[model samples]
Target: MTRRISKTKQFIMMNPIIQFFKFIYLSLKVLVIVAGGHGGTR
Candidate 1:
């Protein structure tokens, strides 16, 4: 039970950093797709 609590606390601490990286990754993916689409059209 104590280990679970500590693990949950650690996850809570890391959640924001994880979310930030996920957001950056998603933005990069979108940018790549948009670039590809523009290049293909031209």
Candidate 2:
């Protein structure tokens, strides 16, 4: 029970940073896709 509690706390602490990195990764993927499409059109 104590281990589970600690694990939950660690996950909660890391959640925001994980979300931030995921957002950055998704935005970068979109940007690359858009740039590729634009380049193809040109």
lDDT of 2 by residue, 1-42 (tens): 246568777886579888798789889999999887643555
Q: How many residue pairs clash in each candidate?
A: 0, 0
- Each model's lDDT comes to 0.79, 0.79
Clashes of 1: 0
How accurate locally is residue 14 in candidate 2, as Cα lDDT from 0 to 100? 75
In candidate 1, what are the lDDT values of residues 1-42, reduced to their tens digit? 246568777886579888798789889999999887643555
Worst 10 residues of 1 by lDDT: 1-10
Clashing pairs in 1: none
